[model samples]
Target: MKNPKPTRQRERHNVYRRVREKIIGLDFSPGSAISENELAAALGVSRTPVREAMLLLTEEGLVEVFAKIGTFVSRVDPEQVAEAQFLREAVELASLRSLSTPLDEEKVDRLRDNLRRQKETGEDIRSFFALDEEFHRGLMDLAGHESSWSTVSAAKSHLDRARMLGIRKIPELGRLTEEHHAIFDAAVSGDAATAERHLRSHLRLVFADVKAVEEDSPELFVRDRDAGPHRRSAFVWD
Candidate 1:
């Protein structure tokens, strides 16, 4: 039996993490082609590892490959974003309800801390978004549903670009902050129903904003006309 050392795993993990972050952070925008040769050269690694990393990203739905053309970052799909939002709400609500007790002082403090940073980082969309993600994941972690965070995180990748547009134009940042506070208070008081209600409302606002952007920026979103019947089912959202 060949035993894999921890360092080898860590190196591979770092490679994949960096590449995935670059893609999700919009360092590589949607439909932007990437060359494995260039990426491997830049990362100072062999094509073998970079190829593996690209494959992992593809599995996460962040990249698409064309047989003869090339590999490009996948485009955003409004319908998929809607579906992701639904799944996120269901998973998170279920997770919150299953919690036996209110969130601990540490978790509550962490959430408050994150919120403070979010407010102070006004107009810094990337930083604010990163903090926002941390806050929600922290809440889910408090509810002992860390694994669900992975699913939500993966789904949110498809929603990010649209969200970036929404966040830029939406003036509801303060309201959003208040919503977070409300959810935190409910969770701290062990009020599952209240927490779930606030959570759903918060997510609904995001969905509305994303839908608006999708309507306004048709080119950025997947179009019904361009999609086949089979693909249309996956791209149509109510």
Candidate 2:
């Protein structure tokens, strides 16, 4: 008999990935209500996989389960964002400092291509977002530490939400694309110092972005630094 464990595990992960993507993309906005039946129906899957997926997300602190209420998307927590940012910045900067003087021209070409697409992406936030991820991942690959991107990525759910908000709020999105160009040029020319400087600056900008977005959409963020699920409408309060 064929073992169903692998297939089941893959299906659960697939469901988790899709749901997590939607959450990060703000389709399931922070602090919003989620109906298991609706979500399962929307994804064209049975409730079992969806339930398992939400369980995984809850473990990741991305979803909250309120007894006698419902499951809710956890509000963006600045602390989590900061922690994730710290992890990403540390790994990326360390990689930058360890870069070889002469970067691979082929890798350089891929980064260039990503930047070109980013420039051409214009104000298409979602498309630009994907390109932005690709550009950064390309940088990691260029340093031959491509495996590090996954670890950086897995820890940055809140950061991703903040970035989505920031991308939406930025008046001139090209500014980020330009930063990518600066980092890429510096790296290709074997200028690790300049590359690291630009990369650090670029990565740190998320602090301001998170602040700006929180100001604009206060409801999308956590209520307080220390709060618990209240009797409120699927939200946590102190």
Task: Please tell me which predicted candidate would have the highest lDDT against the true structure.
Answer: 2
Query: How well is each residue in 1-238 modelled by candidate 1, as lDDT tens digits?
Result: 2557556665456678987777666666666677777777777778788788778888788877656566667778776787788888888888878877635778778888988887787767778788888988888888778777998888767887778878877866777888888987888888889999999999899888988877777765566635422211121111
lDDT for residue 181 in candidate 2, whole number 0-100: 91
The lowest-lDDT stretch of 10 consecutive residues in candidate 2 is 229-238
Q: What is the lDDT of residue 113 in candidate 2?
A: 89
Q: Best TM-score goes to which candidate?
A: 2
The residue pairs in collision within model 1 are: none
Write down the TM-score of every candidate: 0.84, 0.86
RMSD of 2: 4.8
> Which pairs clash in model 2?
none
lDDT per model vs. reference? 0.76, 0.83
Instruction: For residues 1-238, write the lDDT of model 2, one tens digit per residue.
Output: 2556554586678889887888888877787777777777777789898899999899888899876678888999988888998899999999888888667888888889889898888778999989988988889988888888987887788889988998788857788888889988888888899999999999888567777788789878887756665434432111
